[model samples]
Target: MSGEFDFTGQTAIVTGASKGLGRAYALWLATRGCAVVVSNRPAGDGSSSAQAVVEEIVAKGGRAVAHDGPVQTAEAAAAMVEIAATHFGAPDIFISNAGIQAFRPFSTVTLEEMRELLDINLWGCIVGLKAVWPAMVDKGYGRIVLTGSSAGLWGQKQSADYAASKGAMVGLARSVAIDVPKGTDIRVNVIAPAAYTPLSMGSIDPKWADYASPDHVAPVVGWLSSPLCQSSGGIYHAGAGNVRRAQILEGPVHRLAEGDIDTVMHALDRQPEWTSSFASGAEIMPEMVKASGS
Candidate 1:
């Protein structure tokens, strides 16, 4: 099945393509016949880690270029996209995979660190999305895959800033899925990836050593960024050679008469099952209103 998916004329911009999963994605895209633009912060005399990936791709008879610059800024992101367009034509796929992590307790997290994480993780994706949106809209086709984290979806200790940034990405993807120009063919989605990369090796416990590698994450990412992906406005969890969709479910809620503080309190104290009823968002609101009698 994988062999059938070819990207002969497509171009992709993969951020954070210096190493890890981003590098893996760039190489994979190239092998699949897509001309790739690799972007990362300037390093090694203003050359980026993406440069190495570009070299590897070229060695394998694939087309690739590296863009070493800050991707957090709208201007820089625009320039990256422009580079792809001017060189290979308008990008058909975008993977906003650049991210950073600062582990600290919520109270101990500094404003500086918080801002840095948000800038790199959240704002970076926003900039990349905006940069490619118009061209994709005009062409009536596009694919975007935003990198999210499991920490963003579930609570984690000492990951306040990281979780917050990732959580914002989920919402960003969801909103964009709904906001794309009506009838436009653009598809936007998020991936909560659990893979062994430089970022995870030291952080994740060794006992779970069988999880997927960064290379494993690329196939799903590549698929999501392909014109072949028909689904949009969705979240997928991919790792350990497994891929599945994830949905935000709501629990059953209870309603109480207005001004009935006692009933509300009683319900709160006795409604264990209601608290456990994990349903959808649409189910929660009406239940809450009924419980509040408002």
Candidate 2:
């Protein structure tokens, strides 16, 4: 029933928090009265980069801890959740934001490259979800935000692997929303952010820098991770301080008859008008579960 992002006494875990969007998310949560776990793989400087973020949060009178490890591994993800519970409490929010991107032509992409992308971008999310879902279920409440990308929704040249990995996240969010048991309070959503982060800021034109700042995307994420967000299985586009839901719609279903080429052509011509958008998994699954009595 709460429609505000007030997270007092709650805990949050944000991966890839050494910099960029993850850092913004961690800081935002901390400012809103939540204890935070900031995680990132160590840098070549042999320093725990996540610690620096934690330190900054602590300096601002917020509670935070750091975990430095490769988030693509399930063991590492589990360890993060354990640390969160040990230090603070069972996390109320889980942001699966750790990912990697490699741009190479589809024809020239190596198996190694694809494997790496899938492992870090897609599998990392699965690991995070698996690690924290049971805890959320036990508490009967949770907010899970999986990161997606524009490339994933619409194909991008030289980014086949990246697109595939991100696209899988969208599907994962939708399926999880549908499959979770009835009466569960868990909310799962995906954000396809067009932000200027270390991952791609260098390639962005200077003129658009202000509009694409990572800060602009953090609020949308915060909203989704709060009790304010009622919608699940949704894909949102957030950038330049604007937010909107991205829906997957289909043309009206038309019955097909066994027929020759002429009949097929006529059916095509008579296809229902594409006026209304399709319902999301959140909108479609409740009735299904009710019918099945599961």
Candidate 3:
């Protein structure tokens, strides 16, 4: 379906929009005519990244307002959400992209460090959802995008804590998608993106930078943020002009199989056929889904 995905007369709230993936998402939404609330951490050096983004949008005749503060704190997240309502109206779209990453071995990771990542990466998104959900519910329309990571999808050697944080997106998105009233027209999805932003620069080779530009991933997000997307609790991986889905596929029930420890271990070693996944968050029995050709 190649229908136009225009955003005229709409409003969006994008966290971490001062740069990176958030910046790309903000600019793309504005280009398509959506007013945006640009939220970012307050720069300590008397400079304003959020203001700079607002200026860029205004220079292009786009409507945007800068809100400074970290979303890691509920107070700051609420303030950031307030600007969207005050400036444009109840937020029609929300992209939770504000987060940080740390590189440490599981053996060396401390409780405080893990807690910090959780507070910012996972809890921060929860707060943003809590803040905007009521108004969106009242309006009876909303599109929510939560950021995930490859580290979370497939565990990383040096990013155990980060993986734990981002992995939470799956449960969160599905739960929210199922909880929304059946006819509300509200949908929540998760995008575990791989882009050449500050988040990945530390580890990726510089040569692959151009291939991994945020521009390549922005279109997928735009689609997720647009009316074209009809599915909820959808999980996707986007980068370098490539898009693929990530689903929780279940294997056949071995409840009837007879097995001792060794036999059971052998059965578990068999690769699960990619024949089925969950039908919805509320589903008690899993159903088979048509596997993608990709």
Candidate 4:
């Protein structure tokens, strides 16, 4: 992979940056010449875990500030953006990386748990975007990266709430990309990351831990949150020093003459192949036409 992007004079806000993946992202951005806001919820002693991350970056002669709060709140989100603007400048990047997961089966999961998951995982991204979007629009440039999970892409047995939240993030990123005004440089994308951080490892499982370090995932995130990112509304899978694009592909269209069981059965019997996977809906139809021999 080519590391060929400049982040000079840029500012980045990374949520849940106390440790693990978020901390890695913040530090990597700092090394690339971007001032960073390290944000996370305060710890039990009323001190912020993000404070340590800020200290580490500053020790390395990098610019960083810590903002501690429940980022799901609009007030907290606005405060983070204001800190970024007041301390550094208008933030050029926003990494909506804060989230929580409940590991319970669908039938056993409580409504309260579901609500909390949706609030932290899905609503947090919306709140962050609301805070930074106007500044980005006015500046005519921004890179927004929403963190996703494999659970959302392929559901896991005991993560129904987590899966639902992540699935929402994917849709949110796509719609946000479409909503940006024309001729603007704002870009939004989602990453379904697979890293063995504190969140991934409840206990130290040595088998995957070495291979799935958070550092391995930071490179793809840096590229996605940089000016050189070529694609928006795209979902990338990153971890273990490997990266790949994930997309929703469609099979050949079976345009039926009538909505009948017999016609549907015939179409199913044909079992048309998917000629290609698309990054956006706009690319789907033309490829389907070619695949269908229409």
Q: TM-score per candidate, in order?
A: 0.85, 0.86, 0.89, 0.87
For candidate 4, write residues 50-129 as lDDT tens digits: 99999999998889999999989999999999999999998899998998865787888889888988899888889989
Which prediction has more favorable TM-score, 3 or 4?
A: 3
How big is the RMSD of model 4? 8.0
Mark the regions of model 2 whose C-alpha exceeds 4 Å error after superposition: 1-3, 258-294
Compose the digit string of candidate 1's lDDT tens values, residues 46-97.
6566788889999999999889888799998999988999889998899999
For all candidates in order, the CA lDDT equals: 0.79, 0.82, 0.82, 0.82
Residue 179, candidate 4: C-alpha displacement in angstroms? 1.0
List pairs with backbone clashes in candidate 1: 250-279, 251-277, 255-290, 255-291, 256-291
TM-score of decoy 3: 0.89
Q: What is the TM-score ranking, best to worst?
A: 3, 4, 2, 1
Instruction: Report the lDDT of model 2 for residue 266.
Output: 68
Query: Model 4 residue 14 lDDT?
Result: 98
For candidate 3, give the lDDT of residue 182: 65
> Cα deviation of 3 in candidate 2 (Å)?
11
The candidate with the higher TM-score, 1 or 4, is 4
Candidate 2 at residue 189, lDDT?
97
Candidate 2 CA-lDDT value? 0.82
Model 1 CA lDDT for position 230: 84
